[model samples]
Target chain A: MNVPLIARLAKKDVRVTVREPYFFFYLAFPLLMTLVITVALGSLGGSVPSLGVCQDDAAAAYLSSSGAVDVATYPSIEAVREAVASGDRDGGLMAGEYYVLLYAGDTTSSERAALYAAVSSALAAASGSTETVDISVERLEPRGLSLQVRLIPFLVIIAAVVGGLIISSSLIEEREHHTLDALFVSPATPFDVIAAKALFGLFLGMVLGLLILGLNGALTSALVVVFLFFGVLFTIGIGLMAGVVMNSMTDLIARMKLFNIVLQFPALVILFPQIPSWLGMLFPTHYFIAPIISLTQEGAALGDVWWKLVVLVLCDAAVLVMAAKVLRRRMSGMLHLPSL
Target chain B: MTVDNPYKVRNTYVTGYSGSAHVMMIEATGLTYRYGDFVAVDDISFSVAEGEILGFLGPNGAGKSTTVKMLTGQLVPARGVATVLGTDVSRHPKAVHERIGVCFEEKNLYPRMTVRENLQFFADLFDRSVDVDELIRKVDLEKWASERAEALSKGMQQRVMVARALVNDPDVLFLDEPTSGLDPVSAEQIREIIRAEKTRGKTVFLTTHNMAEADALSDRVAFINEGRIVALDTPENLKLRLGRRLLRVRTRAGDDFAEEVLPLDDDATPDRMGALLRAGGIATVHTLEATLEEVFIQLTGRKL
Candidate 1:
């Protein structure tokens, strides 16, 4: 590794990336979207529960019912009630004497009736009283959505795009000005150039990716970071490959758009929850997004998601090697490589 | 010191070498290239020597740039052979490229980089970090050294290009219209730099349709038409061979000018000019020198 060359290449990468408005947008916009989406989804899904309270036997029985929402138990009724009132519940239950008060946030009339009816039925079954005791249910709106959980995948995608913008623009700009030719003619080896571009792109992608994660920590997970590293490599590889393949800026943009539409989009949607397993397996992005969602949404562990990580790594490696070969061919000015 | 030497500077040959010299730094034999069905450079042969500036003149689609690209290793020859510094340009372009500098017609510098950074970056390309200040000074851009390349004027940018091309102190320099976009002063400065390079004993392959530039700097010129060398010789020799009798005389009749036809061979034109000067108010009497443009038009029946 030529340290100075690496440093110079990195500096050049940094200079070009900082100068580009779209590069910042590519990185931050996705992260912002991830934050927006995660917060929106989390807020919509409601807050996590911090405690629970049962004011009476009926409320306790209702909470314990199969249909009751499971909530983590904590100390103090007022505190739990306050937690519920404040939308802090991940969910919980509450009961009261005589009235059988069910302290949950806002719910539909039908849902309230169902809980009341559940409590009424449980009481009747316990005491052999056909007459039902009157009960009331109340709801309190929570202040904010839990956005951290929802935006993780979006942030990662944003990171990948940031990587794409930084790597692609810099590379293409270099080629357009024929600076790449000058650099290639120098003592800087092909590998040196490739490594410099890949590393620079990876750093930029991760920074933008993590910037989104920073705004909302829920987007970040160990597994996501691990897979995101590979995602970054994949983005940079494709970008450098694009740089090598296309001789002009117009061709680069056109090719980037085409690739994103035909290849990148299909792969992203293939991992949706309702999609069939075989179809999802066909897309590399499916594996990347699935593991991230599993980690942030379902709170899954790395051990459980290692296979997905492996698949992403393999895909990243394949693209990188192909990109290197394409780059070599391009420097030699052989037949033009496909844009995407 | 004696006020002047007896021998006049005009028409005096400054012989640095006593005999025929081997000044060919770049040699091409029957080079042929095609882009799809169109042949860009077809069976062209030429050689450039050290301290020699060979003006590559051609029409718009005449393959001058293509041939320069091949020599610069930007493109490989489809057929025939080329050697730069004993390295086959097609096979060992990297080696040939190391010893040469190329300034394409397009402005290819990184616009975002500061002038100093630009020179520094190119300097590092050769693994030699030059004094940026010195280069900036050389280009007469010391004041704009900290400014971005995009901010500089076209003339300033051209100077920077010349500075960058000299960063490695190359053996051969390929300049494509170095002064095309420059003003008179900047163009003259570039000519001075080219002369300085010659003093340093470097070969220059210059490509341009600017006839004045070709005449001013080129030691010999190769006129390429339709991808073939139609004529190649010294500027004076070509002019002497192809010139017609057209002389313009300026006489003081309120900036009036007169054109007279006369044989170019040595004759009594001086005596006739003396009679005209004695008979009329003559402000200026000068030769109607045929420009390279006229020569080009005469030979190719087309303008560059």
Candidate 2:
């Protein structure tokens, strides 16, 4: 392949996309959404739980001094009851003849359990008594990524996918405008055009992936970058294949909807831990998602995720090979190939 | 029941150089192309000499573009032997592409790029440097050099296409309807560029359905219809072989103008014209000659 020609074509593509009015929408919109989602979820996680306490209760004084919860004092027991009933606090604590925990009737089961634990702990501490639970929960594995933190890799993958779609759209535009005819007549071969397009997609994918990672303050390693590169290639391969199969932008969008459904499912599965990991493995993106979360969140070494990386590389190679073959067939006017 | 070779039957005249001494820049023998069962170009053979403009004149879907595509190495013919600039196109398409230029019927320029950038991109493709400013001036696009191709008019875009086709200073330039759908001024400008290329000794294979363009610019014109070439010769010869000579006389007959047609080559033509002039009241008399379009229709039984 002619490196200079490929570079020139890629530069031209970058210039066109950058100058487009929707450049932000195509390249930055995903990262924007990531930022918005990250901020929104971060705020929710940082919110302190509130508790209403009786003014005369010793447990209330101790809980107030703890500063773990937003403590709201009530003038009387009746007021504490009213506060819990009115949903002014998450729950209430009153010390009298018996320790009582009051919560709203509509409180969810998890919230009610949390309120019970807090009241019990505060009363025990006030009474100068130590109470231990009978059952001990043992930890088998170290703590890994938080749900929101793990989502960083997913968002980065999404950015790469969007990059692929943008490249696909650019290729389709070239075909519709008949500029491919001009390139064919020029000295540039079909390999040069394909390589340029693939490299353009790779550049966008890498930049957008790194941008999202940086935005979330996620840890990055050599393995993470390598995995991101392969993930981007896999997604861009889909884009190139789609560009070859579809003739118009309308057809491309319609077809990409189906592809997005398959590709985006792993992101959703990663969010809900109850889903089977093997199910995510059925999709190619699972290889990238699993290893990225392990590397960035679990502090796994490259050797720790060696098997997953192997699968990801194999999948990327398979996809890139298919994409290159299809692109060659299309650009060379061997149109009799069966549609993907 | 095969048709006779029309070029052999007609008296050949040399417009650029003697036939024996002129070098062939492009040669195709029995070139054929098909789309499934439909034949797009069928068993056509022709050659273009160096520094000559051979106009492939035909209506829409007459295999003109297909021929150009094959010659430019865009499409591989199913059964044919074609060479361009001393290289077999099918075996060495890239080598051929480097030495040839092609402007498609459609304005296939990069719409997002400026006129200068568009020419520069193609120039880089050939690895041959070009002076962008001079090319822009040659195509008369200097005023719009900095404008994007999409922002220019169809005529201006066509000028950019022409400029791009000349970026490599190609040995052979294939223009498929380069002047189609352009204003008169733009059309004339493109025609002048073609003439200028001829002056520079660049072989041009111009394809167009405009008979006037072919008559005015072509060193030899080939008339194609239904994927087959019906006749190939100089425009003048094509017109002369199938054209009839006539004398038109206009006279005043009883205060009303009257006209009469007489055969110019007929033995009694002089007698007929003298009788008409002696009758007096003769206002005008002129000889009528057939045009290329008329000759096209007479030979191919189709209007251009």
Candidate 3:
């Protein structure tokens, strides 16, 4: 109800956090993780290795058109073998009635096998042979993101969880310092304190989220921002509850380690790709990460991901209400209310 | 003593005194609070008139802090009523809190913030546009206004806390051990501030274990012990009612000095002192009265 009081309290928290060394690390952790992942996976987008073809123009043309490999035509099989031996190409693809893959001594077996399969398939397609099974690969749309780009959503979710830690630590500091007693005596109510703290968490989470997205060159839209906001709110709710329940920084850090395992389910589900979708759907972060990935990587419109967004909002509301209740109870305890 | 009807509620406004029409700034009747099986504050009743300082003097764990908390709306009373500035603290805590200031015994300051920022932050809480620089100067913290609270000494921090309590120019101020640990000079400065608050027509409910502070700064003092008020009256009256008046005479006896005491109320006391002074060996003669601490020990059988 006291708007100015709430705003001033929130601003004070922001200033305090900015002065703390650990806060800077907490804020930059997500961005740093994204940067390391980007650099590590940057080599995955390197140009495809060129392949030497032995006088099979149709196979060479098909391989070149697919863009998965570059075709270098050789006049004879001996010429293709010479090219492979001399390391002019990664490997040589010789197409006849059947396909043969030639490789240097240093070439990996996996690469030789991959090139053989590609050349055989391309030759079969060009020859129009009924002997081979007629198969067509249909891609509805072009690839939306590289492996690194796909990591942006995961990092945003991470930033949100870190936001929770930031808020919890800040609040525990207030308790340890006994400033919370001063706040209670002031015109501000417990609700006002909780609101201000949650707002600070949201603000920090948004800043970190946008910075990570910008670093990865991922697209940002209103819907994506909304999704990130909900994620931040959910994590902040967890942080608020933890802040009220825990009395010391040590306890908070220990509990956050446990919450990390729980909150990481959505990120794990996305990272591994092997986890069942239904299992991921059970988590609140799943709704957040799913929609964010769709909007940021695939350029999906709001209408396409509206259901997930609705679910995310409902989940965040549930968490916030629970956190508010816990905070009120803890505040009453701090006031030294006699238990009935 | 327990009220049969412990929950009897009263109106916010009560009648004033006869001659000067005094308005009650703080009123509590039969206030009680219990911690599980232990009682922190028993059924105690007291009131503070406008522009009066009521010192709640007691030893540690004597329920002084609990009483202050109940009146300040920081804790709810298990029974009885409390009103601050005509607002029922139990029912309208925020309403009461908006008009009062409190300096807690614990140093609850923002360690990372400078002295000026701390005052400015609290002023914003009351939505008041106060001159923070002037407040800092008033507390004599202008030199350290730019320094963080954690970097200041305990005495300096106490001054900042006092300055913070006055940011809103509150109608009522509750100070819990305003000078618990400080040098004589620093303690004197705080005593001056308390006097200034009285001059500004603000009611102060000060809690402390220092008998001298209560005797010097309080218009009236309440002696509390074992979660109950043993006595409440003016400092002079309490000492006079239970304390003996004596005349001390110092004289030279043989190769050493000697002292003798005589009751001032006794008829033969003046003749005895005159005889000792007339003997020409009298070094000094003076009257002695009981201090508040002696009065407290006599009434409660325990030292402050």
TM-score of each: 0.73, 0.81, 0.80
lDDT of 1 by residue, A285-310 (tens): 66676676566544368888888888
Going through the candidates in order, state the TM-score of chain A alone for each one.
0.65, 0.68, 0.69
lDDT of 2 by residue, A158-273 (tens): 88897788778888888888888888778887668767888888888888888776666543577778888888988888988887779788888788778787897777777776
Candidate 3 stretches with Cα past 4 Å from truth are A43-146, A298-304, A337-340, B1-21, B277-280
In model 2, what is the error at residue B248, expressed in angstroms? Answer: 2.0
Pairs with backbone N, CA or C atoms under 3 Å apart (clashes), candidate 3: none
Chain B alone, model 3: TM-score? Answer: 0.91
**Number of the top DockQ candidate:** 3
Query: What does DockQ come to for candidate 1?
Result: 0.19
Candidate 2 per-residue lDDT, tens place, B11-78, comes to: 22233333466788988878888878989888888778999899999989888988888887778888
The top-ranked prediction according to TM-score is 2
Residues B1-304, candidate 1: write the lDDT tens digits: 1112222133122222223677578888888888888998888877777778889898888998888878876667788788888789777766876788877676777888889888887787677757878877877888999899889899988988888888888899989888987899998888888889988999999999888889989888887878877777778876766655545566666666665544456487767777777878766656667777777777778888
| TM-score attained by chain A of model 1 | 0.65
Interface RMSD measured for model 3: 1.7
Which residue runs of candidate 1 sit more than 4 Å off their true CA positions?
A: A1-6, A34-150, A175-195, A210-224, A241-279, A295-303, A321-340, B1-19, B245-260, B264-289
DockQ of each: 0.19, 0.29, 0.49
lDDT of 3 by residue, B80-176 (tens): 8899999889888889888899999999999999999999998988889999999998889899999999999999999999999998899999999
Overlapping backbone residue pairs in candidate 1 total 17
Worst 10 residues of 1 chain B by lDDT: B1-10
